[model samples]
Target: MTDCDFLVVGHGIAGATLAYVLRQRGHRVLVYDPGQANSASNVAAGLMNPVAGKRFALTWRGAELLPFAAAFYRELEQRYEQSFFSETPIFKLFSSLEEQNAVLARSADHPWGDFVAGFDTTDPGLPGTHAPFGGAWLQHGGHVAVRELLAALAVEGTRAGWLRRETFDWAQLATSSDGAVYAGQVRARHVICCEGAAAVRNPYFHWLPLTPNQGEVLDVECPGLSSAQVLNRGAYVVPVGGTRFRVGATYRWPPFADGITAVAREELAARLSVITELSFAIVGQQAGVRPAVRDRRPLLGPHPTVPALSFCGGYGSKGVMLAPRLAVLLADWLDGHADIWPDVSLQRYNTLQSVGVA
Candidate 1:
């Protein structure tokens, strides 16, 4: 039997980032991950965009989160001696003249002007792209090679004897006021559940309004369109390397609906066409269920009754961008250094005794 400060279940973006933060803060951490290929983190394009939706509203806490995420990834890159995060601009193509005007107007009125690199009303910006209404280049937007990043973290954790590459059995976990014990052995001061979309099955956290949103993405070979920047319209064309770009993703309700569907492929292809005039060949397709919350805010902190148990998930599509900062906050709360913000705290749902998937 071994003792540790934390035993984090599920090594998706949430768990991995939290474990890293905890370890950096001098806590002994053990991560348990079966490493499902279909997990949302593995399939995500890891695009970090500061603005979201058709109205071009600034992302929640974009100004604070973006820079912190960049610095965190850079520090990890230096420690790991590998490259995963890319600081690239996102070219958001305007769907209509009104869309363009609205974004420009918002930029003029708000602090979001700093994020807008430039905008063109005539030139489509990139060659082989079909932006008749032109587009805006956004700063502080980038990509993280998620799989590579996770793999790097796993390697480091494994070498440090802190990562267990096996399924975490809920039946074997026992929590108490003192702490948590797993499999009658490994004891931890706290056990955090970062199970991502699979949290619906977690007995301790299933009550949270966690809605699993199914999403799909495609990897394509676009020979005609070669650019370092991410091109966005209804869908996004993220350049992975060479002429291969990751184009996707389609959001569907009710998790695992039809798994990977032909309809999703066609939908992505249509969106890709709208982004670029260049022809592309679909090389691969992948799907995963994002752990979305009813309120669309991330779920963090501990259980109301079980002080030994906690949760750090419900990041949905923005896990890559949101996890780093949230991990810091969670760690701070765990260390009794700070309180979890009310909006994201799991206690926010204490009023609702029951929550159903919507």
Candidate 2:
């Protein structure tokens, strides 16, 4: 049996970032990944906005976390020798007078007003895609090439003898003569599961209020729309590698399937037809379950009873902005240090242990 310090169950951004943090703290980690774990992290546009839209409020810790995430990715770029983090501004266009007034009002006088910009706009770039009419520009909202970052981390783990690229079987989790087991044989001091939406099935952690969201996306080759600026109308259109735009992300309550959905495709196409000038070709499509929670916070910490087994998941739509810092907190807790974040800890979940997380 291969013993490790940590046996992480997933390899998406949350898992990858957490594993990286653990390894940086001089611990050995063995990751069991299906290479097809479904989560928005792997397939998201990876845009981290300082000011969120729903209520035009600043992201939980936009001032601090945003800078930390930037520095972290830059350090990773130097460490792994890759350039996946793109520092770009996200343009949020106003669809209604109420929305415009809200943004302007908040920008003129708000605690996080520095993140909000008014009046300045992007001259019509793509006709097919919704061009910015007028709204707000949020600085420091950058995009991370999340897939590339994960791939880099996986390579790093394998080189360091820390990652196992394979499907994690459910039967692998069992109690040993002494205590808990991870995967099949990797007995460790502790096992921190970062299994994305599948955390809903973890016997110890399934109780957390993880409201899963099924999201869909379209990968279109909009050669005419290739620009560094991110555009947003009802939805965001992010520029990926050359000529390709990762546009999309419709949210559904039901679970997600790897298979493409006709409803999602139709909705995306209809939305795209609203205002776009670029000649585009649909190149690919993807669907994944977002690890969203009831109060929209991530589940982090160990079980109240099963102290050896822990979890860190449920990072809704803000995975890119939230995962890095949360991972650091989890690592600190694992290393005999106290958990700094008490508000979103799993202990909060066990408060009403009878309630099951969907």
TM-score of each: 0.96, 0.90
Compared with the true structure, what per-residue lDDT tens digits does model 2 show for residues 228-294?
6777666677888787888777888854555579898888866665546656788888888888888
Worst 10 residues of 2 by lDDT: 120-129
The numbered model that scores best in lDDT is 1
lDDT per residue as tens, model 1, 203-243: 87878888889999999998878476899999988999999
After TM-score superposition, the amount by which residue 311's alpha carbon in candidate 1 deviates from its true location, in angstroms, is: 0.6
Error of 1 at 216 (Å): 0.3
Give the Cα-based TM-score of candidate 1 against the true structure. Answer: 0.96
- Cα deviation at 353, candidate 2, in Å, is 2.5
Per-candidate RMSD vs. true structure?
Answer: 1.6, 2.7
Show model 2 residue runs off by greater than 4 Å.
Answer: 37-39, 121-133, 174-179, 255-258, 354-358
Q: Which regions of candidate 1 deviate over 4 angstroms?
A: 111-113, 353-358
Q: lDDT, candidate 1, residue 186?
A: 97
